[model samples]
Target: MELDEAIEKRRSIRGYTKDPVPKELIKELMEAARKAPSATNRQSWRFLIVQDDDMKNRLQEGITQHFVANAPLIIVCCLDRHAFTRQLIEKRVEELIDANVMSREVANMLYQRKLPQKVEETGIPVSAYLDLGIAVEHIVLKATSLGLGSCWVRMFDQERVSEILSLPLEITPVVLLPVGYPAENPSMRPRISMEEIILGFI
Candidate 1:
């Protein structure tokens, strides 16, 4: 499907059919996420594909929005601090080389050398969470193309989700994505006009 068509057709479907989403289809959606551009190609996002009933319920407990647990699949998007640190280091090194301050070999060495120390210091920044938004959008667009449905949700408790998923240290939950066969046929929500949104340089 054309990108614009996918964007227009995609909707936040809260109601879903009980029909199970094929594992392969879910894999394909995630594959699209894996290809999304990340900051410095750090690819800091990690996903937890949650389908089990009990676990899904547990993770949804702290979420004020009850529809999140109703879907057949919930993709928990997490950001890896270590990965973001590596990305920052690589990006900084590249900027230095591009500015003619460091040779190619020197830049590569510097990226590798400083990564571990940065990881020890700051781990990762909240800005890396933006990468998860990009990845989730890719998955959502792909899902729409394949006649699947999803909703990007944010009304959940972070600490509760961390406990429910048993996420490792330094992996922070960023967003929740519910995917399945949609039951509702919601009309497209109103959007701001391009003229209202875009600012001219003049």
Candidate 2:
């Protein structure tokens, strides 16, 4: 499907059909996430599929939105805790320079920029969260392209959900995705005019 069509058609579906989403289709949707780009190629996002009935009920315990439990599958997106460490980014820079992926001058310029520190001052999980966002979007869009419906949900208890999943020490669950066949076709919502949103794009 065309990217434009997918973007337009994709919506937060609160209702879902009882039709079971095949494992093969789920794998295809996740392939998009696996191929998503990450900072310095760290691939810090871990995708967990939760389909067992007992576990799904456990996930919905802390969440108020009961519709989430209706989804045929839930994608638990976890971000690695150390994705923004200076050492790992520096190693990537060295690799890029040595492998001729980028010019040494460019790499040195990046190293001297200290972008991560600036982001840290603002308390943003920059590299890692940004990467996680891309992966989550990929999953949703891919689901849309393949005639599946998905919703990006965050209205859940992070601690409880993480504990239920038995996530590792450094892996943090950032978003929940519920994927299944849509029970309703929601019309596209409004968007700001380009004139208002675009700020002097070159």
Per candidate, the number of residue pairs that clash is 0, 0
TM-score of model 1 (CA atoms): 0.84
Identify the candidate with maximal TM-score.
1
Against the true structure, what is every candidate's RMSD? Answer: 4.1, 3.8
Judged by whole-model lDDT over C-alpha atoms, candidate 1 comes out at 0.82
- lDDT by residue for model 1 over 96-147, one digit each (tens)? 6787866998766655654554555656555576778899999999999988
Deviation from native of the Cα of residue 122 in model 2, angstroms: 16
Where model 2 places Cα greater than 4 Å from the true spot, the runs are: 82-99, 104-124
Q: Give TM per candidate.
A: 0.84, 0.83
lDDT values for all models: 0.82, 0.82
- For candidate 2, the C-alpha RMSD (Å) to the true structure equals 3.8
lDDT for each residue of candidate 2 in 18-63, tens digit (9 for 90 to 100): 8989989988988999899876666778888988889888888867
Question: In model 1, what are the clashing residue pairs, if there are any?
Answer: none
